[model samples]
Target: MIKRLINLPEKSSFFLFGARQTGKSTLVRENLKNGWYVDLLHSEEYHLYLKAPEQFRRNSVYKIEKEGVTEIVIDEIQRVPALLNEIHSLIADYPGTRFIMTGSSARKLCRGGVNLLGGRAVERRLHPLTYLEQKENFNLETALRFGTLVGCAGKSEIETQETLAAYADTYLREEIQSEGIARNLAGFSRFLDIAAARNGEIVNQTGIGRECGLSCNSVKSYYSILEDTLIGIRIDPYIKSVGKRVSAHPKYYLFDTGIANALQKQLTAGLDPVRRGRLFEQFIVLETYRMISYRRSEAELFYWRTRSGSEVDLLIVKHGTIQAAIEIKSGTSVAQPDCRGLRDFGQNNPDVPLFLVGAIGQPFFLGNVQVLPWERYLENLEQWL
Candidate 1:
């Protein structure tokens, strides 16, 4: 197994939040081997707590304390948010005990007003596998086609596709329906497909709602559900300066490329050149974002676009300053023409570093712009940032 970069604080409680199948349980099990585990996903456990959350602690916490176990792990804590009150009490009663809560969804907790363990627990996220963690085993093509879900990464093509397909149809759809996040299940179902097709694109609530037969506000809420479940990421437009006419809308990218394709009902591995290129860009953008997040860097990612079509695919901002800009091209070769966007952005922000990441190219410099193959860029990402 690849070692994750997330380091839990030894003295404090924490929340490990991620989408389903990101290996939260596996990581907890591996790291906290002796911790007392209470999986709310089990029907009996969930019902038991739903009946009397206080009694759960009286029975389970007492046994754990008696056995001298100080670490308590509660998987899918959102299923029984009422238990948070008891957890908070336990923490106060037993000063040495630390609770680790794992959740796949935060909507219920936040909306239900559950105790977040304020100032007591740190929050961390577990994302899909990154190139850094996978090292030599990372395959760009495979990642674009099958995503980097650890459980599905090394499997056969058919198996991987089938798994992702099931994830989209069963897990994603059912979870939303069970959560009762949407008033109309059919409309939400249709919105899922439309949204997936438009993944990695600028948000257009009115247009999306028109296609999905939903209202604009409903479409916005649906997107919120995606964010709450950790299945989608929104990158706001970079408009810190008024020198350029920048678009105000934000771009949304599905958490995983494979899941995005699965939701669109596309199982074919190969695509036409233009379609393939877009997917490649999405794949790289997600990888870059994940790398920065997994390392807990002080970098914020954004996209820059103007009315006349000048665009930089990604802008890495650190400490409220534009540190670096990148343009993604899915071609094997890079020429001067492909550096137009980066060149335009660099005209105003001369001090910021610019790069062009292509399918395959040796690291080279074109004036102020640095060009590198996507693989080489990822390998030397630290230097770029």
Candidate 2:
């Protein structure tokens, strides 16, 4: 098992949120195995708590007081949002009990609850395995093709592809249905395809709605559902004005490339150079996101695109200032012409460091911009920030 960077607090309660199959359960089981465990995903347990969350409190508090169990681990806590009320009370009643709750989605938990855990639990997020955790065993091709979902990692290429395929089929499709996020499963399924095709591009709700036969509002709601479920991210445009025209629309990216490919109904064998390059860009953008989240840095991730067509693939903003601008290229070698966007952005905001990531094996300097390989760039991402 890979070691996750999200460390559970020794004394305080915390929430571990992540997309399904990102190793939340595995991490909790491995690290908090000694705790009093509850699996909300189990049908029996889910109904038991849904019927009476107080039973959980009665049982767990009894065990904590009598059995000397100081830690309580609840998996899939979102399954019964009502339990959060009881949990909040328990935290107050039993100060010694360290409550660790894991949930794949926050939509339910965020609804109509005063003092969600009564300000007692700190919220922490988990993402697909970061390059630092996968380190020496990391495979760029596999990650780009199949993504970093821990369950699919280290499997045979065929098995990895199959696992991702099944994940899309069973988890994404059925889970959304079960969650009642979208009433029309068929329409949501179609929207999934359109959204996947538009991944890594600026969102156009009207355009997507037209394609999916959904209203603009419906498309917008669907996107919100994705965000709420932690299956995709919507990055707002960097809006500092920076003496240049910038686009206003936000860009969207699904959490995993393999799942995106599956939603698009495309096999890895069908990936052309253009498609592969786009996927590579998505992979790097996602890796950067995961790294930043794991580090818990005070930075916001955004993409810069101007009305005149100049673009910086990513901008890292810290303390209301753009600290770094990054451009991603799928090619192995970098040429001066390819550095046009970074150069232009640098000309305007020379204080911000510029980086160009490509498939090149070794690092080189292109004018004022630093050109580095994808792996090296991800490995040293924190330093750049």
Candidate 3:
């Protein structure tokens, strides 16, 4: 398996969040050498923590102070979120110990539950392997088709597809039911399949409701559950006073294309690279989003579009100012249409960085935007740090 970057925080209290089987436990275990693990999924541990949160904290503290105990790994921490408040107090009392907390779901965590970091603990999201992770041996051409989860380029297309499908059934399906995201497995599963097939499109709740045989409100609520559960997300259009013509509909995207393909019933492939360019861009958008949040950067991801034809795929606004305008493309053809909207945005709003992220090799300056591949852009993430 590919390893997480070596630079993430190991000494501080960490709450690792991700979809099930995305390697939350694996990453934490591999990095931790001295932590005592508390598997709350175990019935005894769950009852113990739920019954006496104080005692749970004592167990955690005892582990921390033991001769060999250097840290504490609370697996499935969300199972008993009440322990977070106790953990918070323990951190105050025992500042010497480190913590490596892992959870498969974030539904409660994001709402600022009691024991969570609440601005104190650093939050890290462990997503499935990215393009970079499996790039060493994977085939770039086929991997590009599904975007990269593990750079499984050397693996046959069938094997890679099966892995993704298994992840959907084993991790996503299990997590959803076990965590009570939806009581109806059949309807929810149908939603997943439909959303994946419709990935990379602007969808209103009403349309999805009609397709899924659910009410509009039900569709909206389901989408929220997905966003919170870390399965899929919808990015709203950047609304500004640009006045003349900007589309207001938000674009929806599956969290990972590999996951998207597994949920989809059919593959939509065209020989023309530009034909599927938008989907490629959407893949980059999701990666950029996860990478930003993984780094704990305080940025919100959105896209910009006009009522007519002017558009930009991704926009980053921070601290009340539009900091960066990003446009995504399939290849590196250094042309006007690819760079026009980004350059125009930068020209209209000076001081903001304009960027064009694509799959094409090499990097160059095109007007106000720096045109570069997804990998090249990631190398400079520290600059944001």
**TM-scores, one per candidate:** 0.95, 0.95, 0.81
Query: Model 3: runs farther than 4 Å from truth?
Result: 1-3, 41-58, 65-68, 111-114, 117-120, 131-139, 145-159, 241-248, 266-276, 331-355, 361-375, 380-385
Pairs clashing within candidate 2: none
Range of the 10 consecutive residues with the lowest summed lDDT in candidate 2: 240-249
lDDT of 3 at 184: 72
Task: List model 1 lDDT by residue over 1-385, tens digit each.
Answer: 7897666677788888988888899999888845789999999988999899988689756766678887889999988889888888888888788899999998888777778876677788888888778877887777887788866966898899889999999888877788666667788889899988888888889999999888998998998888898999888888876443243567888998889889988767586677678888888888888777767788888998878899999998888888789999898888898999999999999999899988874788988889888888888776545
lDDT of 2 by residue, 139-241 (tens): 7777777788888877887888788888888877888888877788888888888889899998988989999999989899898889988999878888867
lDDT of each: 0.84, 0.84, 0.70
What TM-score does candidate 2 reach? Answer: 0.95
Better model by lDDT: candidate 1 vs candidate 3? 1
lDDT of 1: 0.84
Give the CA lDDT, 0 to 100, for residue 258 in model 3.
63
lDDT of 2: 0.84
**Each model's number of backbone clashes?**
0, 0, 9
